[model samples]
Target: MTRIPDQPKRLRIVPISKLAAAPKWQLETLRALREPVFFWFTAGQGRITLGGSTRGVHPHNAIYIPPGTMYGFQAMTRTQGVALHMGDPTGLDLPETPLHLRLRDGSQHAEVAQIMDAIQRELEGAKDFAERAARHQIGLLAIWLERQRSSAGDDSPRGLSSTNANERLTARYSTLLERSFGSALNVGDYAQALGVTPTHLTRACRASCGRTALQLVQERRLYEARRLLSETDVPVQDIARNLGFSTPGYFSRAFSAHTGTAPSLYRKARGA
Candidate 1:
């Protein structure tokens, strides 16, 4: 005769009691290949069995599992946190980062629970800006988890470094572009950081990324300009200056060239 252990009904909510009850209602669901499932545990601990190993992922711990990475999880005990089911995920669109978090002491439980509570509210109510709010919180949670893990003296799971010199140079350049695109906006400066000549940097970037270093700089700047245009109420000339363009005319011309529309017109068309 075959034996089947009693399991909690599918998608049933379990009440919070003590730590031992955490795994009482362990549930498993085979999500789609590209689903974004964000996990947070603020109450009890649990074992996350993934990739043929059972690892403990507890409170203040978070990870972003890439698509096609076979994994499953169960609670350590009956605990509460946000289990966000991200919608329509394209693998590259998500952050390629995993987070491990820890608390200073008992005091951090409240803070962690607060963050999860906010996410839970957004998930439950389904408000107009819930998705936006949840995304913002997720970014914040990622940052917070990294800091917590660093403080706890665990930094083992960062992404692999780029393979070649050109790839390394491009990665560093991309980081600098993200930080300074709004002000310094210079490919030469990024090259200086990499201890390489501008020509070499341009060649490396072109070979590895199929674009010149300057083109990457312009691309990032233009990207920021477009984001601000579509999301904020800033003036056009100010946006140009903010993006480090020398003049409004130059910015307008560059924007037109890249996007085939004036910044203002583009924003207007998008109903920003």
Candidate 2:
């Protein structure tokens, strides 16, 4: 299946060890993004914290993390892997949460690695229409993963087969927040929309994501604020209004409190 081209065409392939070379603060920060991440772990082992659950990852584990989920991973050993960062402005057919698949079969593992290599080559070769070629490769990878998920049947990954209440509620909350954050939705409003009490929502959020319900909502907003400040030419006041803040002052206070930088300063620093 061909991926629709309506979404932004940004593709990056990088090794996992780059994290070790990056600044300490960048590695320590948890990220919520508007893109899905595909990773193939070829060496080393570590744990992945995905929303409400943590899973150990080793060689041959492929992770498909959906947009809007909070995720972070660490490599305990000298890790090497291929990671694909894909933007999704059109709400493409990405997973709703994280999928950790262990390719116990050597052939399956090699096939995935080969596809990733192809994506990397297409990206680095810098040929004409390289972006188009990379997107096609990603679409193929997505289809292959879907096939594996279908064949897993009853013994699929716990993240897929299990329906833990806290996990379910937290996933729903994340999805809702991804769509409703700009509308000024609060914890109570979110809880009501999800048909649960604010207290229960907070409890579930903490149990699953290590964050309170209100914190999750605020964090999403702050992430958007930071993203806009770093990537767009929109005025600070305009961004504030669009993100549901009553005034630029309130937005600046919140942004500074959460991000330690005012909007204008962040934009300038990031060269937006």
Candidate 3:
């Protein structure tokens, strides 16, 4: 028998509705990804918190998030969009920061839609060199994003600015949390590392994203626990230990409180 090699993971588009089908915590909780993502909304409205800043989004809004940035959103209405997951943008000329552009001009919207359509077709087809063709289309999309950012000039999203002290501090805290969420570090320990008192750190977090520092830390840990439970067959007790919970009972209680389901039950429900 001839051996077949596994196919490399290619970029793909996910409809916003399908993404919403996931558990609410998976979408609404503060978490970070290892790959960059771009969201293009065609209808409805929502408020998204990215890098400790919350902003409203509506139809024809394009939001770009770089890898390792914490973000979450609440869809106030029926949201409609597609998310492009760009895996390992090692050499792409993409933005290093987040962008939320409201493309008001109909022409601009059409241009983006066209590029996305091309990429989608290439991904769905089995034609020769489809991945390469899709990558070229991604390049075009990157250029479009650059042009939109330049044209927006001063009218760009305010959340992208790092001038605010609270936002900057919260951003740093988010980075540290992403790196060390698995450790047994509490909010006080993190505050000490950042050279701020726990009270001041919580205040800054609330001012920036409406969540206290402790809440952010717990949310990130729960997010990881949920991911591990749903995606792996690892033992529940082992998961608790790996996530820094002092005891399996405590971990189960925390998971149930946040998700309304115990960790073992959650994994069974996910068919893992």
lDDT of 2 by residue, 185-237 (tens): 78999999999999999999888757788887776667666666665677888
Total clashes in model 1, counting residue pairs 3 or more apart in sequence or in different chains:
5
Global lDDT of each candidate: 0.57, 0.74, 0.83
User: What ordering of candidates by TM-score runs from best to worst?
Assistant: 3, 2, 1
**lDDT by residue (tens digit), candidate 3, 1-272:** 12212213347899987886776787788888887888999988888888777778888988888888889987645789899988768777888888888777899889999998998899899799998888888889888888887777564563376437888899889989988887889999999999999999999999988999999989988988877777767788877777678999999999899888989889998898
For candidate 2, what is the lDDT? 0.74
User: How close to the true structure is residue 25 of candidate 2, measured as C-alpha lDDT?
Assistant: 32
Give the number of the best model, judged by lDDT.
Answer: 3
Count of clashing pairs, candidate 2: 1
TM-score of 1: 0.47
Clashing pairs in 2: 52-208
Residue-level lDDT of model 1, residues 141-197, one tens digit each, is: 556555555455333432222136775566566556655666864777778887899
TM-score of each: 0.47, 0.79, 0.90
Q: Show the colliding residue pairs in model 1.
A: 21-78, 22-77, 22-78, 45-76, 46-76
Query: What C-alpha lDDT, on a 0 to 100 scale, does residue 20 get in candidate 1?
Result: 38
